[model samples]
Target: MSYRSWCLALGLCLINGPLLAIERAWPITEGMDVVGELSHAEAAYEDTLIDVARRHQVGFEAIRRANPEVNTWIPGEGTRILLPHKFILPDARRQDIVVNLPEMRLYYFPRDESRVMSYPVSIGRMDWGTPVGTLDVIEKRENPSWTPPDSVRKAYAERGEELPRVVPPGPDNPMGDYAIRLSRPSYLIHGTNWSTGIGMRSTHGCIRMDNDDIGELYSRVSLGTSVNIVNQPIKVGWRKGLLYLEAHPPLEELEDDAKGMDEAVAKVMDAVGERDARVDWSRVRSALNEVSGVPQVVGWEADQPLTTSTSATSSARAEPPAADP
Candidate 1:
């Protein structure tokens, strides 16, 4: 579909709101548990992955993850792209910030607003993995200076770049214009001067957000907001009695081991919990095998026709075969 038509169908207008402030707040009403819908856009001649991702209010890695076959630097015009806008809330109390490392997405649930805002983030590389646990935002800073850790400075020196003990706030500072220091030592949720790395594994253990995204988040979140970092690669949840499975590629460190795969699958099933739903092992296997990072309807109420369109049943349902997985 043309960009205009896609936006209209999704009830989004390109011109009215702040491009970075994409509000995807779904009210938490009884019996409803999912937010957002699957959508798509056609690439124009001048489009890059970051351009499309920003326009759609999605993250860079998310768009890339959903369209692994497309060229990141230049997807030719007319390439139909999958927007992985649909999501299943992580298995946790929906009262604070939740960063799912495997999916490279961050969800912020504001207590007073009764809404959740999500953004794509670049996490640490395999050798410097972001920690997984509960923490609090203990400090907030604007125009924060960077103090290169010993490890980072040493790595840079080895590459023949002279190291500075501190990087002042400016164009050269990787911390961009804002930062939120977590209770975890040396870890932060901060903005980057470079946008290309916002949705990939390119950081040094601190969470990285697009400048605009981090700016907005920095302003709204308080000094003590709870932050939970998790590494769930597979998620299962229900929306109006339909069971959906969303899988992300296992972290590179865990992908080759059968035991790791089993543990991941077990976590997903555990998240599904005691909901009155049945599992279609076939669909489950397909989702597990694909690891598409898009939600798939794996089970539903027995009375509901299995072949029925999830889109028809609910506006936000994610059906099969369209997502990149």
Candidate 2:
């Protein structure tokens, strides 16, 4: 079956019931800047944002950002929620691993494979910010041991809880099952025992993924794979000749920085390079103000003024462009 047909089928199955812990991959067509369709799932009586996010292969922050009004802890039954499955590929080299700090997502482009896989990630907290730069995966390990750093141990001691120097691989280990060490000192992309932190700014300094996601990633990626970390809160890209913009809340530390928005807009413009298009500044401003992670059509070069079918009552509705034959 074609990629588009497969996506439609998958969407149908996903909404009907629970999903397996499998990563979703999208075909990489030539010159396409976006992939996947925006989708929604109804909240059952026992559903929370975290539950829905895990089921849909999205991060908590992404889901919350898309549906700001929904209660994170207990969104009552029948509440319409946005899945945020739609994305504009981050403005970076589409090779190996690309982790966008603001979006709380990691993308992997396998060598010679015509597809990309994405997963939600938990990055470092504001004080112990994750660095931004290109690095290589220096090592890979399974059932990794965790040794709490001096600072972490000191903090735990202040709370009257002593930590062991080396934590063995088990249920108690924070570094769950697998790890991919980056060239940057003391930082790793690894699994987490506490999966609730998978889509938020709660980690100390390393990247955290769900146990299943890290296992799949560890199996696919080899040592020396390039890992590029970037902080882009506003992303713009083209799909079927229409320009789409996706905005995420800026990191707390960078919110007050004078050069933040200017630099972000510059990056968006750079990604839309050389494509003749006129941007709808009004829509752009609205998207910026709301900071919704869902992709919105911000401009077009053709004659018809762009309009979206999405409504306030149903924000997750998507108008994916028809697939290439």
Candidate 3:
């Protein structure tokens, strides 16, 4: 089948209402690394990309990249905003919480181990990159105050602005209402009243989530919960008999270290392991080129008829360009 046809077969269709985002816990299957379904909805008159993103539990960059034709500031009425809700699970331990920096997304696996919850997040910018590794949640705080670090205060000072020594819990406090403190005091996976940064690299070495998401997660987690953050831009996984590849634009600083097709091809090889399958190199390259963060089929079992994956840009339901990003 053609790539577009495969997506239709996969039923990466439209969805509506409060039923979006990480509120849905995807069922986990043994070796089934792909989860969630691709969805897009028409923008209401007052909607901007970020507004639509927040409503659908998607990040700014993810939504923008997926719908390059839509306006970021004002996607005029009826414009279809593609929500990159589908994901290729990061290659990390599937327990506790896992934050994938490149995609600016987090996956939480509760003790039940039968399903996973996904959320969009904002990570530290290039200079103060969020470090990777396994860390445990050491504490939880509600209505936390924000004490500007010297570096942060110095930044405001250099810009000829004054920052109060401490910002009390309130709307102005960017720390949001709840914070999941990590083993290291310097780090936190916290909620943010500032939803603008939820899906971008715009933090000070901390992980930020939508206020609502973190609020719910806070109650579900306790001290000593393991949190593993990884930076995997290219993820490969299997579903049924096909091999899928999902790519995200690599962190700017790490782009120079990437080997392009060679790296992606190798990752597929590692994932395929001893299993017999045939891969479509061209499709793999196309997926890499788009860096959609939405998984697409790249291979199938050697004995099964191959269905080439197409980097479907949702052009069939093309939303007219309204504003530029």
Candidate 4:
């Protein structure tokens, strides 16, 4: 099928509002829990993994892990890099907003829309970890200023650099173009000056997203949207009668949340419900351990009809991706 026909069939069309936002309105088909299609991107001569990731709107580590055999700095020309864009929706409640800390990602379910938008995110570091719970989008601010907490300022001072208490909004500010305040004090879902930090654990207890992603998201969300923060590292979901597993590296600070592959197996068993599935233990174990953020088939019922895999291929641009550094 042509791309237009596929979009018409799947309802995964890129809306006219933004030409280059990382987030896409992925449809939620009845009984199909997984969203987004996995695909491959061939590297050009001047392409790095980072370039591939940026052009594709994925994170650095996601592309790097999926293409482990490829060189990070130089994948050379014509290298086929797997894009781990497909995801298994977490086993948590689908609400207005769900930010999975372990996955370093966010999902937005717009009101009355049969679609969800996904964006890569950066969570808090070890010392100042992002808390898990439901909150509200208390406020929205464009060109938000950066108020370096004493902890942040002191850290800068220790580096023999004097940091300002309140850095006005501008290019020098770490807080990028937009910010959505959470009910949790000093916590926010905001854009960052550095898009490379997306999918990283290096924030000060706030959620940081790519500026372009935020620019689009900030306008779409309302002040009272419910924000549910979860810590789901291993997701087991079904699509087209096939069971797939998507694993993300758990936050270093919260390693005890899930027991790695064992937890994945248990989830699959529970999700299997009435279906008798032939579980592939080896594939499950490898996917859980690799934590490549790509969904891999783990189990399927023998009586089910054969289904085509959505993994496709394309070529990524050699120029800089759609986001600012």
TM-score of model 4 (CA atoms): 0.85
lDDT on C-alpha atoms for all candidate structures: 0.77, 0.79, 0.80, 0.78
Ranking by TM-score: 3, 4, 2, 1
- Stretches of candidate 1 off by over 4 Å are 1-21, 254-276, 305-307, 310-325
TM-score of 1: 0.83
Lowest lDDT 10-residue stretch of candidate 2 = 310-319
Q: Candidate 2 lDDT, tens digit per residue, 268-291?
A: 566556655555555666787788
Report the lDDT tens digits of candidate 3 across residue range 1-325: 9653454355332222353434458999898988888877888765566767877778888988888778776688898777787888888878899998889999999986789998889999998889888999998999999898899899889999999999999998888999888987889988886675578888888999888889889999988999998878899998777778988898988778666677787788888787766666767778899987778787666666533342333311111122324
TM-score of each model, in listed order: 0.83, 0.85, 0.86, 0.85
lDDT of 4 at 310: 23
Count clashing pairs, candidate 3: 0
Give the local distance difference test score of model 1: 0.77
How good is model 2 by TM-score? Answer: 0.85
Write model 1 residue lDDT over 212-273, tens digit each, in one string: 88888888899889999987788877787777888887678655643333554465456456
**In candidate 3, which residue pairs clash?**
none
Tell me the spans in candidate 3 whose CA falls farther than 4 Å from its real position: 1-23, 305-325
